[model samples]
Target: MYASLVRSTVALAALCVAYPIQTQASDPAHESHHGKLGTVHFEVACNEAAQREFNLAMAYYHSFVMEQMKAPLERTLQADGSCGMAHWATALASLDNPFGWPGNVSAKTLADGAELMERARKTGLKTQRERDLVDALAVFFKDTEKLNHAARAKALEAALQDVAARYPDDSEATILYSLVLSANFNPADKQYGNQLKAAKQLEAVFAKEPDHPGVTHYLIHSYDYPPLAAHGLEAARRYSKIAPAAAHAQHMPSHIFTRVGAWAESVASNTASANADGGKTWNSPHAYDYMVYAYLQMGQDRAAHLVRDGALSNPTPPDHFAAAFSYASMPARLALERGDWAAAAKLPLTPAAGAYPWAKYPQAEANNAYARALGAAALRDAEGVSAELARLQALRDRATELKLGYWVEQIGIQTDVVRGFSAARSGDVKAGIAALQAAAAREDASEKHAVTPGPLLPAREVLAKVLLDSGDAAGALREFEAVLSKEPNRLRGMAGAALAAERRDDAAKARDYTGKIARQTARADGGVDGTQLARLSVTR
Candidate 1:
C-alpha cells in the first residue's frame, strides 16, 4: 500500500465497479479453446494473454457473454439509432482498468462510447436509458451521500436498472447486479431484510447460470456478506472448479471463500502458485498478502512460508517478473512482516518489496505490523522499521509533489497515530495528548477519502490507557467515552473505555457500555480474544 494513502478516507463512494466485455464459458472441453490454438476461438479462450476483461473473459470461460447480450443490445441501439452504442455501457465500464491492458483500445472505446451515449441522449434515446451509463460511470459508481440501508439499496438498484432491463437473460449482469446490491447489507445490523433479498437474488443468478464466473464469485460473496447466510458446500465445490487462475482473481475469490467458510479451498490456487515451479507466473504480491490472510483463516501455521521460501529459493521463474522473483522481495518487507532473525541474517536483495497502503491501511498499519513483528528482537528491529519509516516519509513527499491532498492527510494520520502511540506509551502524558489531537486533525482532513476507518480507535485507546495507568480517572473516562462516541464497537476501544468509566466511578455509563461491549464481543466471536476481555471487567 502507498505510504501516503495509509491515513486516507478514500472516496470509496463511487469507484470500485467498472463493467467489462462479455466472455464465454472457459471450461468447455479443451479442444474448443486450447493449446497453441490452431483454431483459436476468441470467445472461449481463458489465458492471461491480454489485459482487457473482454480478451480474458472469453478465454477464462467456455461460453460467450456477447451472445446473451446480442438481442437486447441490438434492440437498444435500434431503439435509439446509434448502432447500439448506448448498449456498450458495460463495455465502456471496462475502460476504467488502471493496469495497462486493453491498451489504446479501452481509451478509444471510452471516447467513442462517451460521444455516442451523448448523441443518443440528445437524439432522444428510446428510453433515455442511463444517458450514457449516467453522465459518467462515476455518478452511478458509488453513492457516497447515502449511508443507510434504504439509500444503499436505492443506489445499487438504480445502478443496475439498465442491465436488468436491457439484458434480462445475461446471468453476468444478474450476478454482478446482485453483488453490488448485497454489499450494502450489514449482516450484523439488518435494519432492513434487504441483505436476505440480496442473497436470494444471488441464488437466483446461480440457479440460472451456475457456472457463470461473476455469479459463482458473487454467490460466494453473498454467503460471506451480512446475515452470514448458509452456503452449500456444493457451491464452494463449483467455485473451486471454475475459479480463475490469475493472481488477481484468486486473491478475491479465495478471501470470499474464506469468509464464507470454504476452509482448505480458500487458498488452494494462491499457495500452489506461491510454491512455484521454476517458471514465470502471475500470482501477485497482493495475492501473496491475501494468501497469508486465507491461510491464517484456515489455521495454517506460518501462512506465508511458501511465498518467502519460493522468493528465497529462486530469483526469477516465468510469466511476469513477479511469477519468478528469484530473491525474496526486498529484505525490507520480509523483516516488516516476518519475525525470524535467521531470515533477516540472509537479507533479501535491495529495492525490497513494499506497497502503497490501501489508503485504508495507511503507514500506521505497516508500521504497527512491523513493530509487532519485533517480538523478542524489538531493539535490533528498530533499524529496519526506521528505514521503512523513511520510505513512508518519502512517499508523503511524492504525494505532495503530485498535489495529492488525500495522500498528505493520510500520511499525516499515519504519523500522528504512530507518534501518539509512542508518546502515550513513553509516559509523556501532555505530549500524548498533543499527538492525539494531531491524529484527529489528520483524520478529519482526510474525511472524503475515509471510506474505511483508520487507527482512530486504537489511538484513542492508547491515550485512555495512559491516563488510566497514570491514575487520572477523570481524563481516562473522557477519552474512553469519546472513543465509544466515535466507534460503537471498537473492540479494544470499547474495552478501554468501559474500564476507564468504571475507574472514574461512573456506575451507569460504565455498566451500560460494559453490557454493550460484552454483547458486541460475543457477536465478534474471538476477534477480540479472552485476554483482551480480561482487561476490561470490573467484575470477575
Candidate 2:
C-alpha cells in the first residue's frame, strides 16, 4: 500500500512534464500591470511560458480562487521543470486550508502538499524570493507531529512577513502576508488587531491598483470580522467584477452582504458564483449553501427549498474540502432553518460517498450532529439526543487525535448545548440554562468559519430559543439581541426577539421588532409568508 502511494505521488509529480508548451519570451511592453492580473513577479526561469503560467497561478492564488491554480502551475512546470517556484506555488494552493481555519487540513492534503514541496526543493528555485517563500512553506510541512498548530502557523507568518518586506514592490507578497494575518485574526478581540493590520496592508495596495484581484480579495478577508464588515463592502462589491471567472470571487461579496443583512445581494452573489463555474467547481456546493441561506432570510421559501432539493438530488463528489463541508451541512441547515425538527432527526449521520473526507475534519461532522441533537431535543426524544451527543463526543475524540484544539473545543460546545437543551426539555431548568449559556459564551470566543458565509444556527440563537421555550423572556431577549448584533436582520433572531419582547409585556418593543421584520421581508420577492409573520403578529 505504501509503495503504491509513493508511486502515485511520483506519477502526479511527473504528470506536468507530459504537456510542455515551449514558447518565445513575452513582449516587454505587455509586462506592465493590467486590470486584474497586475504585475506579479515570481522570478521563475525567466521564460515567457514559465512567466505566463506563473502569473496565471498567482492571479488565482491571490484571489483565494485556488483550485483553479493547479492547471496553470502544472503548465508552468511542464514548460520549464526548473521553474521551481511554480512547484512551490502549486504546493501552497494544494495545501491551503480552504476554510481559513487552523488545523482544518486533511492528512492526505498535507502529505500531498509536502511531497510537492519536496519536488520543488529538489528542482531548486532561481530567485532568493522564491527560495524564501518555498522554505517558509517547508516550515509548515516539517515534522508535522512535532510542532503544534500555533507554533507552525506563527513560523509561516514570520516567513511570509519577511518575504513581504523583502519585496516591497510586490503587491502579491503583501497580499499573501495580509491573508496570513487575516486568517490568524481572533474574533474575541474587539479591536480586531490583526485584522486591522491586514486591512491596512491590503488597502495600501488597493490605492495604487483598484482592480487588483489580490487587493480586493484580501481586503475582504481583512475586514471580515463583524466589527469591520462595513469596511469590506467595497471589496465585496468589486471582487467579482474584477475576477468574474473565479467562482470564489463571485461568492466573496456575499460575505459582507450576509454580515450587513443584504439578503438580495447575498443571493445574487452566490448565484453568480454557482453559475460561473457551471456548477462543477469545488466552489459550487459552497455557493449553493449560502444561496439557500440568503433565500431563506428573504422569506423566499420556495427558492430556498429548490436550492436544497436540487443539491441533495444531484449529489456530486465533493472534491474540495469546502464542497464536502457544504454538502454535509446543507440538509441540516435547511431543516433547522425551517424549524423542521423531524427532517433533521432523520438526516443520515455518515457522509455520502465522494464527499470531501469531512469525517477527518470534526467540525463538518459536528454540523450534522448539532442539527440532529437539536432536532431530537425539539421533539423531546431523549434517546435521540443522547445518540447524537455520543456521535459528537466521538467527533471530539477524532479532533483531539489530530491535535485540532479548535474543533475539539467547538464540538465540546455543541455537546454541551445539546445536553443542556435535552435537560431543559426534561425539566432540569437550572442546569440546562447554565450549560447552554456556557456553550454560547465559548462559541462567541471562537473565530467564525471562513468557508461559509455564515453559520446556519449561531450558538446564541439556539440559546435564545431555549430561553424562550423556558419562558425566560428577558434572558431570551438578551441572547437574541446578541445574535442580531453580529448578524443584523437574521430572520429567526428577529422573530425570537419580537416574541420574547411580547412575552415580557414590552408591547412597544415587540411592535418595533416585528415592524422591522415586516419591512425587511417586504423588500424580498413575494415577501414572507403571512402565517409565519402572523406568528409574531407581524403583517404585510
Tell me the whole-model lDDT of each prediction, alpha carbons only.
0.41, 0.73
Distance from true location, Cα of 265 in model 2, Å: 0.5
Best model number under lDDT: 2
What is the Cα-based TM-score of model 1?
0.47
Candidates in order: C-alpha RMSD to true structure: 13.3, 9.8
Question: Against the hidden true structure, what lDDT does model 2 obtain?
Answer: 0.73
Tens digits of lDDT, candidate 1, 342-362: 344345332234432223222
